[model samples]
Target: MSLRAVSMGAAYHTAGRVPGPFYRLAPVVAWTVWNLNPAWRRRLTRTMLPLCEGDRARARRAARRALQHVLEYYLDLVTLPRRDMSRFERDHLEIFHNERLDLLRSNGPVLLVSAHTGNAEMAIQALTFRGRSFVALVERLEPRDWAEYMLRLRSSAGGTFLEANFAGVRSCIEALRRGGVVGVMGDRDIQHTGVCTSFFGRRVRLPRGPWELARRTGATVIPIFSSRKRGDQFRVYVEEPFVVEESEDAERDIRAAVERYVVLLERHLRRDPGQWAVLEDFWKVHACGEG
Candidate 1:
């Protein structure tokens, strides 16, 4: 069991933002098999939420069903050919297809804050199909082969990948000023100076880059996501722009803004825990005083 678990972990960790659809689809295929089988799904469900109340077996069953529903859509993403993805866009138009229409249709820059809850790749694809102006911030992939492949894939989605570093910020700011949107995910703390906030009822580090950039640029802060829905479709949720509240204590005010973002992230994750793909001790470093 330990070997099998470690092997899966290694595989996922090594596949950092692989751009090709095949590379991304491989794991989804494995996950779908794991999810389709009732017994296996129930076992994983129980292991994931052992702390939940009620009869362990019954609780696991309900959670298993919910996960199955989520996985069904993930499977569709892999199995179905997305040819003329334009058609799929129209079918789900109600799901925020028009929320950023003006910004995308125009030449001005915008900031999009996303989290790691569902298949974010689909959201990026949707933006590209609609001629959205945006660049996505992500950690640079190591190894020459991997980096080259990922950049190609990301470019197909209309995103210019800015490596996570000081220089990347300059590029991101440029994109915003050029009437393009900059996309960043805030759920995980990749920066040493990230603001600490509560998540899942416990304090953890949250990235402050988006809020800081928004304040500096006077650009809109939009929270956008594409979560899996029934029947292999996606529900694109777009919250109104977030304004950074000013205060005498700027540092404290920044932390406060981050806390609010964390709260919304927690609520969304709680609504669909299976959508979260985290497997490590997410709060471990914080709890140990290392963060």
Candidate 2:
């Protein structure tokens, strides 16, 4: 087993045996570290400054809270399997615009596009509780064991996982053709072949795969967002789905479709600026160095 697997295994077993109050301390420690760590502070400030409307102080505060929330999110994941499902539903999860989900259920196929903000993993997991199953495309993390461990956590609620790769893309397309739902991240360009678009009054490149896939498969593109309300409680937003408009210029059409999501993503980020968890220099032209 890898080091990460070992650590996660230890945490899982410990959290399972210990009381819930003890698990709560993990976020406290994470928050302190997030504030003290220089590298994390710099990255957070750089990514959040503009998002906070150029307010340096507000950006710094949001950065600290963003890290704290992200850490809390992961801690919740490790202990999720041990929590009571009924209690979780009654006390933790809240769904807004659920009729949109009903629409998705009645529709054929869908491409669920979400950002790095909030507990996105949990959003996908929420579908399982509602008796909906979907395939999520995720980037493989470092240390094979850690990746496997995360994949296990993500699928524990009943969804499927597909690594972000060529084969995974093919599998996603096939699944969509068969009227299956596929969840993908829309905020960052993992493959570096993204299309440039305006976000928060700045230019950033977003992944084109989701839009391209939607166009090819005639899938409805829906924007989903998850926000941590307090402690382990969360609010999930499922927006209406829109079909990508096709035009003679395929590339332009794809860029336009991506721009639409960019607008939606920016709106969500503005609403909950602290929950936006992207750590990269998203607006920098050469951030990816993928020439």
Candidate 3:
């Protein structure tokens, strides 16, 4: 069947034990899904429409590649448990502007703000290889077993996860206070706790957790992203990091962080819209304010 047709739970629980098939057949399944999944095509194409300057044809092509990238990420993700992480880091993952990660030691409890465009997990793995443990803030995926499996793979590299909950928030705060790295995705607002912001010149609500956490903890907020350069070769880009000033105007501070993040997000998405692996319609479906 198609790649998207299989649930993560079933995939991991069954064929995941033997990832040889997953490794070889992933591209074929991704291609099949991209060609046959009309709903998926429509969703990704619409998400890329505004970005492509009205070229629906180009948007379609980008949509296909975007889906392929997402599938490749899943293939690597589901099968990563069996690989040599050290070799994976050495051969597959590379970080750009790596010196910026030094902020973790200089003035730390670094908060990495990333989007869905790239495989942020690769970035996490790269950090883990460098001996920096992280407290990654993650949204719970569906099918409890699948989520647990993912969390396990995530923790395999000497890091921990902060689930999207009050307890998780507390843990994240504690970790930051202890001068640890905490990663958060600043793109989707699954919690509905986000402040309205602009993205791709359209109004959307990105997660407030990253910026608010930084404001509260005074953590260094670094905008990072990752992309598969070829196949499994991932390049993690570390953008300029900043701190959200805890001023008397708290709302302004958070909003400013949101605005700055979106500007960079838009810039990266523009570079190669196909790297945006989000399958949902980002503008209307996920937006808080009308565009």
Candidate 4:
């Protein structure tokens, strides 16, 4: 059997046996990925030292432990078990799905801005299962097989997948024009053309895509994040639309929107630090000066 199939089968089996297998699956996956993914391993060493302080060598060791926690969470998400939630997940899903369904029913393009918070992948299922044209801008997949597997998993939403690039931006706009919802992560930096802003009392760059898309397409920018509740349950928080003013100076407008987004994101992260899994050097504000 294929690796993806094996993983899927194991996930289902675990789900049937336990209340939540994601918690268990996450650590194992992270450890495996850490061992296999040399790129991430190097990044972990470089990015983590600032967050942990001790002897330089010891700091790198400590950082690995911290990265493990965050990586494990990522693993849990990639291998999330069947959403056939027990009593706990069911009740919360009802409230969240119902409200989102209502919003989707309305005749307007929506920009669903999400973050890397608790079980966010599940949010796609909750929003799209009932029939809504939703597309997400996904980062380029590495390790061809894993990429293919992610594409299939994401296809559960029944939405088109677009690469995170200019072409993808065009496709997203077109999708929005057709009255579809386009979901994008606004909290993390895209590293290209991102506007620097303050987050968690430090300067960090955020993707300009969502804000620009909203301004160009006139789509309602709605903040949506699904957080794990007590057991299998999750709370999908959907805030009201943010009204962004357009300006002749496009840069100014985008920056203004980014600043507002930073505020909203900061509030959420502070309220639930665990839910916000930003383990990288997110606050490395200034560009390193020339030697």
The TM-scores of all predictions, comma-separated, are 0.70, 0.90, 0.89, 0.72
CA RMSD, predictions in order: 6.9, 2.6, 3.0, 5.5
Per-residue lDDT, model 3, residue 272, is 86
Query: Which number leads on TM-score?
Result: 2
**Candidate 4: stretches off by over 4 Å:** 1-102, 230-232, 285-291
Tens digits of lDDT, candidate 2, 168-263:
899999989998888999888887888876677666678999999999999888888888886677888887789887888889989988888877
Instruction: lDDT for model 1, please.
Output: 0.60
Residues 1-291 of candidate 1 have per-residue lDDT tens digits of: 354344333443443223245344644564676667766565555534622333466445445544554444333333323234456566643465455545656565577788765656556556666777567777665564555544554554345776778888888887777667788887767766787765655556778888887766766777776566544456777766666766577787678768778766766665666565443345554432432
Looking at model 1, the pairs that clash are 107-179, 108-179, 109-179, 109-180
lDDT of 4: 0.64
lDDT (Cα, 0-100) at 149 in candidate 3: 67
lDDT of 2: 0.78
Could you arrange the candidates by TM-score from highest to lowest? 2, 3, 4, 1
List the pairs of residues colliding in candidate 3: none
Mark the regions of model 1 whose C-alpha exceeds 4 Å error after superposition.
1-85, 91-108, 230-232, 246-248, 285-291
Error of 1 at 280 (Å): 3.2
TM-score of 2: 0.90
The list of candidate 3 runs beyond 4 A from truth reads 1-25
In model 3, what lDDT does residue 238 have? 88
Tens digit per residue, CA lDDT, model 3, 164-210? 88898889999889888888888889788888876776777787888
